[model samples]
Target: MRKRLSVSKWAITVLSILSLAFFFTLGPASKASATINYGEEVAATAETLIGSPYKYGGTSPRGFDASGLTQYVYKDAATNMKIPRTSAAQYKIGKAVKQNELKFGDLVFYATGAKGKVSFVAIYNGNGTFVGATSKGVKKVKMSDKYWKERYIGAKRVIK
Candidate 1:
């Protein structure tokens, strides 16, 4: 009877120690894995559409216009947040972010036609590049290019 009682206590002690070890090992890892970076997710989703054709008012994988691409990406990547269908309207929805303070999923607007007007929008890809649907097609371009640089209007932060 004494031997059996000691063995039972030993088993309980081993089980408690194993349970604590498992909890400590997996607690933070599970949390880290669950965290979702919405901005990075948007940027990644936009990148997958490179080479997609550009359409005047297109809004799908088939083809996309400047604003259409932005809209589609936001809808597909961040279902919780919705953006307007046009560049001008989109520029209105998000909090204004300065060019120097831009982030991964920020919407960078441009005045391709008239100065001070938001005519085009692109997803800022960090460094100095942005992805957008241009006349040629969906592609990444340098924000420092003479044309883009001069036409830069402002940027908006849609992902918080």
Candidate 2:
């Protein structure tokens, strides 16, 4: 009787695993809705910082530096996932993605000094632009802006 019970339990576990695999592989509606929701959340959070002042090491509505901006944006949009508070620190986290593979909400890094130190991070908004805080304030800038272009290090996608 004990052996029979053990076999039944094994069968139940296997069936449960198979069911989950089928649901994830075949759930089209669920997958699409999740993607749309993520895009909207990222866009909304970015828009909220349209006029925030640039404050080095700041992380709130009152002000934000480059890394602070990235942290705030992701915190608000990414369902509470904690990201590093500085650009260099953020660079050390997340999977490294190629420049050509960058997607919206991805973290783009820029090198600061001659030694290629990561100095800044911006949210890649697609269409060749990114949103970030600069001396002027939070605003959208061209990906090709000379300073950024020269300093471009890489990108990271933390949301996925």
Candidate 3:
């Protein structure tokens, strides 16, 4: 019985080695590149609300505040990504991104009210532009704008 068991173990080991060898012959697996650009999709979704009214604590089509617009855009894009409701909380998540390296859909934060305190957020529209819900409602603003440039706190990448 011992001898029979040993033979069975030997057969199993041989089969495992053969299977590994066969897998290796196929070479290193290639990573599939994502065809869907999530950042772009998110930016597009934000654009749909360009003319939306500004509601201090709003988070829907009727109106939106700074953070509300960002959260709604991400949710609407169907990325399954959820962000914090307030700009300060949203700023706490995601990797820090440099202003020069900003990409589409990256969240750009600002200290609209006080020094070193995040109070507003916007979605980078690439090429130095961003969209957010301001006093005048949802609109695209340039990063080079004097007001925004002065209030610029930093940026974060929420999308992978």
What tens digits encode model 1's per-residue C-alpha lDDT throughout 1-160? 3554345878999999998889878867555666788988898899999999998999997999999999999999964567899999998987898889888889999999887899999999889889999999999999999999999989999787
Candidate order, lDDT descending? 3, 1, 2
| Candidate 1 Cα misplacement greater than 4 A, ranges | 1-32
Error of 2 at 28 (Å): 20
Clashes of 1: 0
Better of 2 and 3 by TM-score: 3
lDDT of 3 by residue, 1-160 (tens): 3554345878999999998887777646434555889998899898888999999999998999999999999988958688889999999999999999998999999999989899999999999999999999999999899999999999999999
Per-model TM-score on C-alpha atoms = 0.80, 0.73, 0.78
lDDT (Cα atoms) of all candidates against the true structure: 0.90, 0.82, 0.92
lDDT of 2 by residue, 34-54 (tens): 345564467568767979998
The number of the candidate with the highest lDDT is 3
Q: Of models 1 and 3, which has the larger lDDT?
A: 3
TM value for model 2: 0.73
lDDT of model 2 at position 96: 93
